[model samples]
Target chain A: MRIPVGTAVAAGSIVALAIVPPITEALREPFYLGLCLRLMILAIAAISLNLILGFGNMVSFGHAAYMGIGAYVVGIGAFHAVEDGIDWLANGFLHVPLAIAASSLAALVIGAISIRTRGVYFIMITLAFGQMLYFVGVGLEVYGADDGLSLYMRSDFGDVLDINDNTRFYYLVLALLLATLYGTKRLVASRFGLVIRGARSNERRLAAIGIPVYRYKLVAFTVAGAICGVAGVLLANRTDFVSPDMMHWTRSGDLIIMVVLGGMGTLFGPLYGAAVLVLVEEFLSGVTEHWQIVFGPLLVLVAVYARGGIAGALRALERRRG
Target chain B: MGEPILRLRGLTKRFGGLTATDSVTLDVVEGEVHAVIGPNGAGKTTLVGQISGEIRPDRGRILFAGQSITRGPVHARALLGIARSFQITSVFLDFTVAANVALAVQAHAGHSFRFWRDAASDDALIEPAAEYLGLVGLSDRTDDVAATLSHGERRQLEIAMALATAPRLLLLDEPTAGMGGDESARMIDLLRSFKGRFTILLVEHDMDAVFALADRITVLDSGRILVSGPPDDIRADPAVRQAYLGDGDT
Candidate 1:
């Protein structure tokens, strides 16, 4: 099947990104490619969160725990697998899959408890749970005790998929990110997606029409968490290390900022948001150290003036042009 | 043709110092209009809430379609064929009028998990939604955003959505709460046309509409039923006349 129109544009952008080796020798560095990979991972994570907060109307503030748990799955798996001298499964492919599953299961338990309440209470409970996980993660002296753990070798998915090769891993991130955007678009427009949109619009009305809203929301949250687990596994691979800092509250804020900056409730918002956020952190900081002082209020102004965020602004421009 | 579609036995609710609904016992027979009327703050809305499974009672049982549904959640109560419209208009304002009704129909037509198909373009959802909109006289405004519709029109759309679910019992709170005189008259005509087709529990402030359409009347005041009877009897009863008509206001 064909990819969507917006995704076709993104596909072209990736082709341009692939040709960076000719333009600047510095652009071809593994360091720069690694940075782009990091952005893609965060975008994947933010898009997952959007399904719950934007469409489901369930604002979960503590989504970083899935990332942390996903990170630790690799850390702990590699530690035990290496110590036992079992070279068969402790590698990247086996470890990352285990990490994804662990993250999703943890999300299920966390979502079940958090979905009972709504509004601000839901946000707080989820944040509390994420913080609790972060504390536990930090307490793990077994995985270097707050200092973090380094991977001795990147997980190898046998012969075809070598994460250590920057080009191969970059392509991998690009494919997954594009696929996530496609999957999310299909979901929001689908029948289940309509239920999600309805719940966000007026949950009571949805219930009065005989649709089980709570279960639907829980399922959305779990699915969002499962998708986020993929981002976490990739983040661990990109870093070649795992840390409790991945679950920190500020990191969660960064994720929210991406979703908000891109736009909430609109498709392709996360892509624009992720690209803007990562580019700002990389480029703006180069000009001055106090870049956030400028960036902070700008973001605030964007939120205050552009309630629909950048997408709304662009749409406004399009309307003016036409 | 069948058992009472909805039954309430001593449904009671208290709001701390205030009791909203006290010992409300109601039965809505299949295929009839059962209207609840009273002055402002008379607990009519609370009774509707209790019956529709939004608010649980302190003590009592609610039966729907001849089965105990007291323990069921709101959607469960709805799936058993009871639907409700709000006092304030509650459509998704940003969506088109057709989309709002289609969402209700979508909830009933099939599982909403079909991700690839455009929900709006699906004829299965659109055709029935258009029919309901036409039934409510909103077909011309089908593509219009709900927020742009006139107030009375939104109220009509509210009813249109409630009906889209194909409910056996419809609980309507202030169905014409903000409508003009003409809108109120039109709503009564709509109710009259809908009578005996499906059961309805209407809570309205309009005395004339109530008297015009109620097959049976239940008068509530201070969370207690002042009286319950035929419209003619309730109209003449001194207690209801004094409590609702404000001694001489009617």
Candidate 2:
């Protein structure tokens, strides 16, 4: 049997990402490693958003809030670790779990209210909640407020893993990205995922068939938030900085664009989306400072011409080849 | 012939000054097809909405299987063996026809929180789904996407989905609404095949299908039941004729 184009591309990209650190080291350019790391981290966030936006048909505009929450959890924990002499708070084990728990809690509360509305109202309510989190970040006076906080050190994973090393951290992020992709694949194909997809397609029909669509959607929303929180943790470690800007509504917009650009419901779409967007932005900004002017029309053309984004275009090509 | 499977007592509903259903009281007997017939704006859809738990009555109580379920949510009512098809075709258009029915089967199977196993390959869902599709004469289209199906085929798929729920009472709103003559005849035959095997509360505009398939008919005018009886009695009733059947305006 012929391998699907999407699967081939996804597998090829994974192999390529696995060797990025070695190639960058040989070239003596660590910046490329950092860029790839950033790409993978954002890809994780985009994948989480796809759970709701692409599969569940929830257009959440405030997803960046969870990433903000995750980063802040680490930042605050490190702050307490250094200032208050609470060293255990610096543990990666503690910070990662706490971030997941906190972000899921926030998602639960936001999803409960937002899932009641649909279409533009859902978008606005999610945006409102996201902005609420952004301002809360700004109001945090002890945690460096709007200026942001710097981590004295990366998350302490003990001897089990060394996230402080650039090469080691890249692998860690890569592993997590693969796990998210695998877990999501299992999730969307599972009974619970079918409920989510079915609800997206026709909520009323699901209700009439005895499925409580609201509860299922809220769970999917929370799951997506928790996964995004993990991405946030990695992001904080990668940059050694945490700020309210992490969860700004514009950042959330960036995540949405990544999902749309990759392919909304496709498994490997977000990764491709993140790569293209980060690489294109990097390339365009290098050519001209006003890169957004060029980028804006480029995205519109993709949206109008390619209905399903990059992954969709690939599938179309494969179909034509057959 | 059997005790009431569904009872609506003093089912009143209003939208501002317009009373959509004015104290509409009705009973659906077990193992019978009871069709609700009315002219435009006579509140047929609203009545179905209240029975299926989509719309809350301003003042009323709905009982199912001799239990009070007046304020229960839609899914709750569905779990209690109530299922409905919409006036407009409603299905998971992106899913395969089998998958659409599989979702209905999955609903009645158990809690859907199992997030590890692949649902599409589960024979437990797919088998029952296929059986129901066959029952609706849609077995051939089981793997086809629901969106690709024609209008009448979607109506059949809707019935298959409702049947998969193993519901005790089926609420069918306009099942033959947009069908051609041959399609309507086929639908009537399908409903006729299900006459005694299931209890159906049908809201429809096709008088011929209603007359042909209804074991009992309730005629509504101005949100109130003008007359109700077997087909012969409904045909003979002058008020129903003047208000609905015989009226040239209909």
Candidate 3:
């Protein structure tokens, strides 16, 4: 029996990511490890966004707000730990839960209002909420505000793990990414996932069939926000920095680009998108300063010609070969 | 006849200056095939919309099983055993026919927050979904995407979905709307087979279907009931013929 193209792609990527640490050490190039870590973290964010965007048909434009909220939780926790002598606040246990809860709360409020709207209206409402959070981050003078803040140190997990060791941190991030991918795969196939997909397909019919679509959508939005917050927490730890810019609208656009470029509805599409987009940006920037001039047209061409993005193109090729 | 399962009292809906449904009151008896027939723009769809909770009546009460559901949202009414099919054939076109019916069954099974087990493979949902599809004679087409089915098959799928809800009142909006002669006969036979097992409120422009299936017929003209009675009485009534049936176009 032959493996599906998607499975092969996912497996190949996972193996590549798993060996990156050793490969970097062998080649004496640590920069690629850092880049891969960042890619995986953003892939987590994209996956979270896809849960609502691709599955639930909610095109949220403010998803980065949750990531920013997660980053700030860590940044603020570390700030208090150093300046106010509140050391427990710096614990990873506190940081992760706090980030999840804070982002979930924000999502609940935002989703409560925004989920009622559809089409471009929903998009605008989410964008507005995101902008509001961005400005609030800018006004947070106690933290670094516009300039941003540096973490006092990596989150403390006691003797269980040391995130200061880049390899250990890389593995931890990879584990989270793998968990997210697996969890999302299960989620989309589960009853709740079917409800979300049903809503995406025909919300009226779902409601007519006795599914309270608004409640499900709100739950999905909150779940997505919470997961994205975790991604933000990992991002802050990886970079040792947190700022309003992390949750800026453009960052949210970048996440959408990743989802669209990979495959909107497929399980591993966002991972492919995140990897390809980052690599393309890195390679293009090296070639010229005006990289967006080349990138803009390329994105448009994908949008116009390849409606399913990279995953779709790969599936088409597989079908042809078969 | 059994006591009224659904009562619409003074139902009124206006779009801007146009009164779509005006102070219309009607009762749908339990286990009866109640047909609401009218000319174009005569408010049959609007009246159905009010009962199904898609449209809020400007002034009226919708009583289902002796409980007021005028202000209840669409899904709440659905849970209370009301299901409706659209005239334009609205369904989850991307999903399999079985999956579409399964989703309807899953809606009533419990809260769909089970986020682990694969829904596609669940025997609990798929079994009942297959039963409903078989009832509608769509057993063979269960695995096909809904969009791949013919128009009549989609209508059958729609009925299957509505039936899977185990609804107390099935609201069918022009189930034979665009059907050819053979397909329409099959739809009629399907509805004929469901005559007593399901309480249906049918909105139709097809005179033959209305006459053949309706135990009671309510004729609407200019957003108000022209008359309502047994099929023979509706057939004999001159006012209904002049207002709707005599148009010759139908």
Candidate 4:
């Protein structure tokens, strides 16, 4: 009946985070809530990437494309509603679900073609598709094109939930993060998860045993894309802006780095990774403008020394204690 | 016994100037251990590859369970009850022994689109996996990581995984290629236990195991079938003796 230490830590962190909104408000520094919101959004995005990269071994360098697509869906929906005075995009329930659906559809199309190729080719193809979408974003003349698009107001929940209140939004973000973490945990341990992990280990063997591995990998890729799309909805609400820069390949690389740093293949590793990477970026940028130069070496050191990332290190410590 | 479970017709594969499998043909009857034996260049592995649908023949039709599956994909062939064990051990090294077998069971059970329940504890997958592991004498090592097993044990584990798929026909490629004398004998006994229950296509370098297990033997030479008949006839054939079994041996 021993609980995995990583799971315990993740649960504890979520509890602490649930209290941070109130504590920060009491201290009159409500800005900290904003930072925590960033952490939650990034964690959701990273967790989605981890579903494929860590478990299925699909090294997609275009994951952020889904996030961008999701954000743009909300942006475009708002654009139609606010500018054109339409009710279709104005509906919260319809638009949010539609955004996720569109993202999953994009992943299915991209993954079908990309999953056929292996190794470096898969990475390059995903990156190429992501860049294609980024260019598309840049080319949207009606939506501010290269500059970006801004929402006049947060998504309308229509009495269901209020996105205007920072506290309510913070709680919504927290709830979604916990749900994603818990759902991903179940997903990676189920029958589907076993097949995906097996494909990563040995695709040929899995096929020999009667598993249609390509179809399974494609499903996983689509699911991950849909989850990241939901994160994008939160991200758009947080910043109230959508841009091609959101889908840039470097953003995908950042998501990959977070998965790698958190100890991939562990359910809670992405959250740990997102927090560390996002917080460190904030901390170092505050100290000096040339934060990347300082941060770059630290990432290399972790990549070199942290064999399995933070969660792996924690597991080792727990073993030593036992 | 009424009809052959597996039939290969005019199977041919050419690698540039060299012919790997040249217009070869064979039949494997139901519920019989059929052994394919050859020297290093006889294309035994290549033949296994073509039948398993990993390698497509330039000109041929593979009939499995009385259907032409020449163009069928590898996994489609597997779903039609053709299970193959690799010459090189290929079980999931990172998974536990039970998990390795459970994956095989899961593949055959139904669509593995299940994403909620914990598969590791599923009685449907676990019970059958344990049974298959027991068949290969690996029931006690269920919880052990597959990579930690000895080389011979891994080979046994590979066979266990293949068996877990519940295939009507088993394609074993050099099942005892790297095993100690004790391990080899144990493998032979385990395979022999399934003799009449499964139609097995075996590729082996070990003549003793082959002679002991094979109901029929096909001797391949230079990418062609030199001789194929009952084990006694194969043993007595002078062509087989010169081509494969050297004169000094028997």
Q: Which runs in model 4 stand beyond 4 Å of their true positions? A: A1-4, B247-250
Off by over 4 Å in 1: A1-28, A81-83, A91-93, B1-3, B110-113, B246-250
- Screening candidate 1 with a backbone cut-off below 3 angstroms (N, C-alpha, C), the clashing residue pairs are A92-A155, A191-B112, A192-B112, A192-B113
**Per-residue alpha-carbon lDDT of candidate 3 for residues A44-101, written as tens digits (9 for 90 to 100):** 9999999999888999999999999999999999888999998998899989999999
RMSD of each: 2.8, 1.3, 1.0, 1.6
Q: Residue by residue across B99-164, what tens digits does model 2's lDDT show?
A: 999999999998999999999999999999999999999988989999999999999999999999
Cα lDDT tens digits for candidate 2, A1-322: 9997877888999999999999999999999999999999999999999999999999999999999999988899888898898999999999999999999999999999999999999999999999999999999998999999999978899999998899999999999999999999999999999999998898988999999999999999999999999899999999999999999999999999999999999888889999998999999999999999998997899899997999999999889988
Q: Whose TM-score is greatest here?
A: 3
lDDT of 4 by residue, A1-322 (tens): 8787766887798898899988999999988889999898999999999999999999999999999988998898888899889866867787689879999999999999999999999999999999999999999999999999998867788999988888999999989998998898899899999999998999999999999899999999999999999888889889889999999999999899899999888888889899998899899999998999998897798889986889989889778867
Give the DockQ ranking, best first. 3, 2, 4, 1
Q: Which regions of candidate 3 deviate over 4 angstroms?
A: none
TM, every model: 0.94, 0.98, 0.99, 0.97
> Which CAPRI category fits model 2?
high
DockQ of 4: 0.91
Best of the two (1, 4) by TM-score: 4
> Scoring each candidate complex against the real one, what DockQ results?
0.73, 0.92, 0.94, 0.91
Maximum-DockQ candidate: 3
- Model 2 scores a TM of 0.98
